[model samples]
Target: MSENKNKSGVGMKRSGGMGGGPMGSFAGPIVKAKDFKGTLKRLLGYLKPQRVKFIIVFIFAIMSTIFTIVGPKISGNAITRLVEGMIAKYTAISQNTALLKSGKDAVIPIPSIDFPYIGNIILLLLGLYLISALFGFLQQYIMAGVAQKTVYNLRKEVEDKLSRLPLKFFDARTHGEILSRVTNDVDNISTTLQQSLTQLITSIVTIIGVIIMMLTISPLMTLVVILTLPLYVAITAFVAKHSQKYFAAQQKEIGELNGHVEEMYTGHKIIKAFGREHDSIKKFENINDRLYNAGWKAQFISGIIMPMMRFVSNIGYVVVCVAGGYLATQGRISIGDIQAFIQYSSQFTQPIVQTANIANIIQSTVASAERVFELLDEIEELPDTTNAKLIEFPKGEVKFENVDFSYKSEESLIKNMNIDVKQGHTIAIVGPTGAGKTTLVNLLMRFYEIGAGSITIDGVDIRDIKRGELHNMFGMVLQDTWLFNGTIMENIAYGKKGATEEEVMKAARAAHAHHFIKTLPDGYNTILNEEASNISQGQKQLLTIARAILANPTIMILDEATSSVDSRTEVYIQRAMTELMQNRTSFVIAHRLSTIRDAELILVMNKGSIIEMGNHNELLDKNGFYADLYNSQFTGANLDNEVI
Candidate 1:
């Protein structure tokens, strides 16, 4: 994995894999023939579970093809019988007239064929039609069910993969793009499989049936029909190849467009505050333009396919009509035979057109499949290790041993860092904006890996411990708190699934959030919107703290937990924090040095290196980085309110 070399900050870590060169460095987007084969193999693998339904539907399709062929033939037979009967009746009248004019009683021999035979053939044609229609419905229903079920399973698998993947994956990619894959791309696959696969199957079957019936009627005529096949194949193949590329490009642009839309909505407040609505519109237009052009190209190519196929089919029909007429005129074949040959030839070309339509669908589907496979193939960070086991962190002793880390190989964010927290101790980490303070906690949480050294819990390497077992020990309260769109009670209980109502209320009370929650009309049942935007930042943080407290983890990490609250709320929050940290291993990062004056250990960091370390007053007495920072910044920050 390649890391970003040209960035710096405490929270500058990439979200997915380690930074690497361009993902498709050696191979480009054009899928090779072998690649297509591999994709088809995987797609077919999804069908294993639906094999029984597949076999049933396929058998019905074959029966439907037979009925389709038989129905047209019976129609031709009915027409032939009606025509022959009319001709025979007319000849008899002519002969009778000639005999009577010669002064003799004309005796015309009447053909003994039953006229109702034509009606029976017509009835038989209707029966065949009914059969075809029934099977068509069966095939459609079964195929649609298979497609939907396949898509459901596929989406679930991708969602699970996303959850298991490291946070870094989300950092590099836009949420909209990922959403596009799961929703839009998967929908495309469903449409293609349900609709196109059915048509393709029927077309292939029709092609075979037509050839067999045509050859049985006239080999020469069948050969003439076969001659037109190459033209349809050439046109469809050319259009399919071109259309696939454009379709793939179009889908890619759609993902990009979706990404932009999601970003715009997510940052709408920022854009409006800065009066950048026009700028957002222009940016959206740029992506919309790309999507439009790609769509236009794909549609243009796909449109040409049907017209071109119909033209070739028309030419084949003409050839069969002219040749069949000539054969009938010369008495080389019966009128019924000639008629059947023409009908068969026409029927044969229908599949060619059907095949062309299926080609368009397959092209579009392949594009979506490619995008979905790309995400599934992504490398996950922090793969589970063999022999990893859960650890018993009864005391929550955290120790950092000569830890070093960087967002990229070319930049080092933390150098030879070391820290340790005893059971039930509070350690304060104070630093400038880019001094790797947050990066330290990120490593300890195993959000990112250390370039050198290790983080240990209860004297065991965290990397050697199961991720869930290790993370279950700590509860984090971030400065920017996030609450889902749910009731207050539900949000608090989210930290501990299946938590009782009483437990949630007690945690809320402990965090000093119960009073405000009680004032709301819905109280603990009040539903929040996205990110809890309806509530004040302080309330949100307190709710989050309540959630963390409800989890009852052995270790607690507070990142500027009280920064958003007012001075009046800050004291209450401080008291809550003190109570929460008591008898629990705690790490605090604060801009206000006064908040950490009673901390058991204080580490002052500068440029990824710890410049001073001791208890709060001991470092202040030393008059080093800690003293300079406190006197210049935090000391003057709260003096007016006497917050210290």
Candidate 2:
């Protein structure tokens, strides 16, 4: 069920994966892309269709940031209005002593308050802010839709691509690495677009608008604001460049750490059995320490952007204030204009700070994008044949002629191998560990293509047959049983679509699983947990056997099918397997020679070659390697339960 094609041999060991994972959580890679411009272009292509929405977002962002930019200017005007109004009124009242004396010295009338002017301007400022808030809200809402939909499409493509990928692809990467690419990387793109993209636009617009406003007040003061721009840019670029490498390292280290955690957790029982708890902890800490080093460096470098910019901007601010005061004294600009210019000068540095921060975020997004694009760019499985035939339940004759294969092509594992089997004849493939037992099946099932050779079913080449048709002709029960979180009945009948309740029960009975099912509280309706942890190993194996039995294929392949169960359970499974093997060609891969002593044709394999091929008794009479292996079980030469 897991599609573990080459589950043994070199593929089982650790293969370093591609990117960041859970430990770094939302913190994406810090590395610069090999082609930043190209990646950015491709990333934007997803949003290209939402041009209208983006345009609206831009307009709204400009409106919002501009309003924010204008707020301090408006406040400056209010202050000037209050100050000058009070002065003019006082002067007028002092010159009108005659009117004050006529009324009464104690009854000095306060100048009529400019209630209408103040009220109208306050309302106008409120109206501007209300409109700005509306645009800002609309911008974010529409952008969220576009961002989420883009990633939704991306995730779909990744999922679809996974199904078409070759076994070698999965073989080369850990599941955690693939998971990080689709989920963590895609999420990074979404977060950056929705939050950082809009912020970037707003920051840029604010910078430009603040510049224009300052120039209008006085170009001399605008120079003061502009003088600090280069310093801000230099600081951001320097820190960002240094931080980028750490982010990349952080992503890689986190991915490795996560893969280790996933591996260790899944194999915790094995570790404990071997008394390797201390070793496992030490291994985890090594990975964690590398991740910590990278993470700290990345944050520390990027962290320099804000405070440094603030320090430089503060100096510019002081310069502007002193210059503005001089110009105001010379009467070249109104106090109000000088005040507005001061606000603009202060506002200028904020966007610089924001842009610098967003630059750091963009680097991360690009890192995520690079990994995402890399996965999408991987070579998929070879396309199915154009004129493929659909062989339905071909007579179980299978042949392998002049076969050759190697994981790395230079070191040939299988060379010029040949095998021929008659219909309904039991073929038991025996081999030592790493003897390419699973790999042989993998090639037969087209999980991996042979380097040189042809495999056939009933005189027709397997390649000529459609993959789906070929798969339907064979039923495989590997040592490792896989089941989904579903009812016991559902898991058993999985391969047989829309199977009747009676039919499912019959298959379960055939696999010797019905007795256990009936004993359970839920009978056939018993639910399985995600890992199928609720049932014993024997029970899970029985369920898989039942599932395979329901398929009713022309041939059967059992790989260490009874290895996990006790001797008593093994007897029951053997009976079920014998019953299932009746009238069907069976390929039983086993290490227990005793179980396969009755096999019609025993193929003794060593290092990917068949050293001997004959019936059990015939091999024993020959007293060859097969005889030695069979004799070793009784002689105690092979201490393990499995045959040598």
Candidate 3:
């Protein structure tokens, strides 16, 4: 029986598991780069508002590229000039010797040339180089500034969209995956955006300028260089297309790994109690293997790009030398021109290779962009209406009329449920496992919308009210208590910002938690570990109650509030709850029937429908579902328990 029960509990659809669809099960591994062009254009559109800064940066980039192009040209010219001067001197000497040998020794005149032009050319080249360096730095500085700003706003926008999304969105994504997008993926975009644009623009411009210069010097050589470009471009595109899919997959796998590890560590005690260490290890290894394979695949494709490009570049060099040398020997091109063409070919090939190499980063950036935008484009489940207005709670009356709900559309969790609680009334919902108690609470809070019918507060539909204002009217404590890592003061103050220390203590006292807290070394100043794991379960629940009490809401919903405590602690909590719910509308869902005898209405539900409804004794007389549950939960108990 115990084994069957455990199996059933494990099979209970694990809450907060990823939903919607399976991840990374595409027919083909790579998503085409063309598919993302529109997203890239949309991202670039964000720069429109900063057009002035963009233009300034553009101007600097052009200037830098011009200087970069000029550097190779100047150096090529210097080489040609030096070669020409040597040839000229050698030719002069040969002619003078021939004149002397021919016995026409009439003092051979040597060609004298102007020197200022050569000096001016050399000086011009130096000046252009210095200017290029200055503009390069300026361009990089401005672009980096813009990239940081763009990323900052982009992250802020994603965060805002996430905040507006309904709870179901979070239910479908792991916390680590979402965090990676907001932090890791966003950081990748910023880093790549900062450096890639400036480098890409400069390399492209420089490559174009060098090719044009080569064409003017020797069109044949230029054609040869152009022929080699297609092969490099094709290879880069292919590798990038494949690498991007793996890169995106790699990121997703890392997120899954993080989430899996977090779950294992957080629930280590439970796993140990069940002796599931080997099982957990196998599970972890599977996720880790997927991550490792994805990472290696991405890096392998990226690694191939540079070496392949360089090999193609070398082929271009061999072709240029053969073609250019033939032209120079045929007297169709001067030696100086041939040398200059060779220099320009090298210049042209280097940028193409560099661009091909950097394409890896560009692909990764695009992949990150795709992931980020995918999140931004997610259709929020239940967006609040634009015209929704705030409706203040008069007396905290709540009613559900013919309500129906389904967590997933195929199966209903709540079915045609009708419930009403008057102002200042206490209602208890008792049901077998898998009944709709939690679903009812979810609908009440509007975390999800009902499939049919409506929920109202004081006769006004909840949908007609702003969600924020509607939720502000109630305080809730769930079965599993969650506390963030923070000082006790911060956690309690989360209920009401600007709550005084005295008010915090008052609420803590009201929850019957003050005595234990005071015994701690630092009291309110003591820091809690993640999930407050160091604290006892009773203490955690009490702290949760203190938070709700501090909010001072008109309506309170407590689900299994004292389920994890000892009898003494349960009694203490019960007393505190009595005081907290005095003259306030309240709802309780508890397995402990003794906890709700005083409730004005007690509902006994099974499957997805209510089977019984009444006050305590009236239901006991009926000898139905409610009576059976009450007797089973309170039989042979202390005499006080029977009365309670």
Cα lDDT listed for each candidate: 0.77, 0.79, 0.77
Q: How many residue pairs collide in each prediction?
A: 8, 3, 0
lDDT of 1 by residue, 252-330 (tens): 5655665567677878899899999999899789878987887787777767766776788788888878888887778
Per-candidate RMSD vs. true structure? 7.2, 5.5, 7.1
Which candidate do you rate higher for lDDT, 1 or 2?
Answer: 2
Q: Return whichever of 1 and 2 wins on TM-score.
A: 2
Which stretches of model 1 miss by more than 4 angstroms? 1-34, 48-57, 101-103, 109-113, 133-160, 181-193, 219-312, 334-346, 356-393, 406-413, 449-452, 592-594, 632-644
* Better by TM-score, candidate 3 or 2: 2
- In candidate 2, what are the lDDT values of residues 1-644, reduced to their tens digit? 01221221112111211223211212233346788889988988888888788888888899888887777677667666776778767866885776667775634555755656767767778887888898899889988988888888888888988888889898987665677677777877888888889999999998898888888789988887787888877876676566657766775665566567767888889999999999999989998999899988877766666678678878997898899889988988777777788777777777666675577568767877888889999998777889987765588999999999889967778888899989988899897887888888888888888889899999888888877888889898989999999999899889698998998999999878899899999999999999999999989988898899998989899999888888997888888888888878999999889899878898888788888899999999998887778777767654554445
Candidate 3 runs further than 4 Å off = 1-41, 87-119, 180-193, 230-264, 267-308, 322-340, 353-393, 406-416, 451-454, 634-644
Pairs clashing within candidate 3: none
TM-score head-to-head 1 vs 3, winner: 1
Mind sharing the TM-score for model 1? Answer: 0.80
Stretch of 10 with least lDDT, candidate 3: 13-22
TM-scores for all candidates?
A: 0.80, 0.84, 0.80
Question: Across residues 1-644, which tens digit of lDDT does each residue of candidate 3 receive?
Answer: 22332222222211111111111111113322344677678778767766787788888988988876766556666666666777777788888898888987736566544356567777888899889889988988888789988988898999899887887888766664676567766776787678777777878888888877887788888999889878977886687677667766665666566656767887889999999999999988997999799888877777776688678878988997898788867977766677667777777766775565456456556666777888899887576778887664458889999998888899877888898889889999988788888778888888888899999998888888778888888899888998899998889888997999999999999888899999999999989998697789889998999999999888899999888788998888899888889989999998888899899999888887988998988899998777766765557533333321
Give the Cα-based TM-score of candidate 2 against the true structure. 0.84
